[model samples]
Target: MPDPAGQPPPSSHTLWRAFVPRWAYMPLSGEGAARFGGRWNPVGQPTIYAARELSTAWAEYNQGFVQHPALIAQLRLDAARLVDLTDPAELDARRIDPSIHACEWRDAMDRGKVPETHRLRKRLMGEGADGVIYPSFMSPGGTCVALWRWNAPGALRLTVVDPDHRLPKTQASWV
Candidate 1:
């Protein structure tokens, strides 16, 4: 993806992943963590594709989404973390179906195409370091997907944080 505001693209070697407790099913201890991921519940929750750079994650999460307090704290402290899923087999196992596409929200809204989906499958299929790292279709400063992989417990290391701790207000940046 082209750098939107003259900013450099993310480093080719590293990608970040963000988690929200409610959406991500991270178990305390078990193999099930390997299956941790979000679902595409259009009626319940709209499809969201995002990742990378703590600041970008911050902007995405703090965009007036009105998350639960506990979840907010959890995200602020630990849900967002760096990840490395360089193995092709590991990444393939968690790849989203090639047929499932994501919409470009802005374009759709501007053109009055409310529920239209763009060629997301095509974009995600494009090459990137380790996997696919692309700019977010929703947020300018955010990445939509990094590494193009998920649900690999052995590859992810979630940081544990105090659920009650609150992040400084300075971190909340709205789009």
Candidate 2:
């Protein structure tokens, strides 16, 4: 990792996410979220969502409704540049109110208005942040990360946790 700004990353982190088995081969893909938009991203801006803990991942995926079988994955993030939205000091320094954590992005979108969360993401992104870590609404005390860029130059590296070639590589797995 080349440090152009001469600053090393704060640390490495591991995250967890659950997806449909058909999309297991493309765990890093954010096209689904892009098409529909999410709490952290507006429509057309792809974002990968992950949790700091496995239980939190399950909670996020289930969301109180019965869901189809899922493939839970452990993800690795290396030297990633992320802003912790849950940090009070950072929020105060950035002049952002903590109420954003409870933003009703979906309802706002349904009402044809841009969500505050979307605006927050745009601002942080423009400031060169790769992603954000915020307290999860689905899981109390749980933290989640929303990444827009990874595994590329001038960005961080993110990898799935398949060690023995267990996950299928071809798209045929989707069929």
Candidate 3:
């Protein structure tokens, strides 16, 4: 089953590849850096120093650097945003919110599905899994008429046949 954000569950590999290197969680495409020591250094230097300090402070506050619950929670949230899960789901028959589910879906997608060739697939995956993925028919002005496949016993399969040749839009709804 997919995570809330429609991704697979998190694993050590996912955590390391997606989170540890980016432990500082630096902002992208801006001349800004994380504030530390009441002064701002260049994006890289100051943030690195601040990260070290934060790690130390976190260790001091939590009595160890390993297994800090708050840091772990923050990392999980940040990782979810990074991988674009941000959806809720039922796992083992229990409901979970988007943030947690996104984390899971990301892990699954990273390890499981090969990237899709369809334009919409790129858009939906890029947008943090909020977009829907189902078969669709083409309409005038290049709109997709999607058909959702619900989980049911012996559900009837529906197919859409588009006579008009319309290009599928690759735009992501959520950035």
Q: Which candidate number maximizes TM-score?
A: 2
**Pairs of residues clashing in candidate 1:** none
lDDT of every predicted structure (CA atoms): 0.35, 0.85, 0.25
lDDT of 3 by residue, 1-175 (tens): 4557545342211110111222323211112222311011221322111111223324333433365443221111111211212223232332423232123333343455432222333443453432231111111121111111111244322211223523123323212
The TM-scores, one per candidate, come to 0.32, 0.92, 0.16
Task: Residues 89-123, candidate 2: write the lDDT tens digits.
Answer: 77876777999998999999999999999998888
Better of 1 and 2 by TM-score: 2
> In candidate 1, what are the lDDT values of residues 24-51, reduced to their tens digit?
3331222222243222111222222335
Candidate 3 stretches greater than 4 Å from native: 1-94, 104-153, 163-175
Q: In candidate 1, where is summed lDDT lowest over 10 consecutive residues?
A: 73-82
Worst 10 residues of 2 by lDDT: 1-10
**Number of the predicted model whose lDDT against the real structure is largest:** 2
In order of listing, the candidates' clash counts read 0, 0, 12
TM-score of 2: 0.92
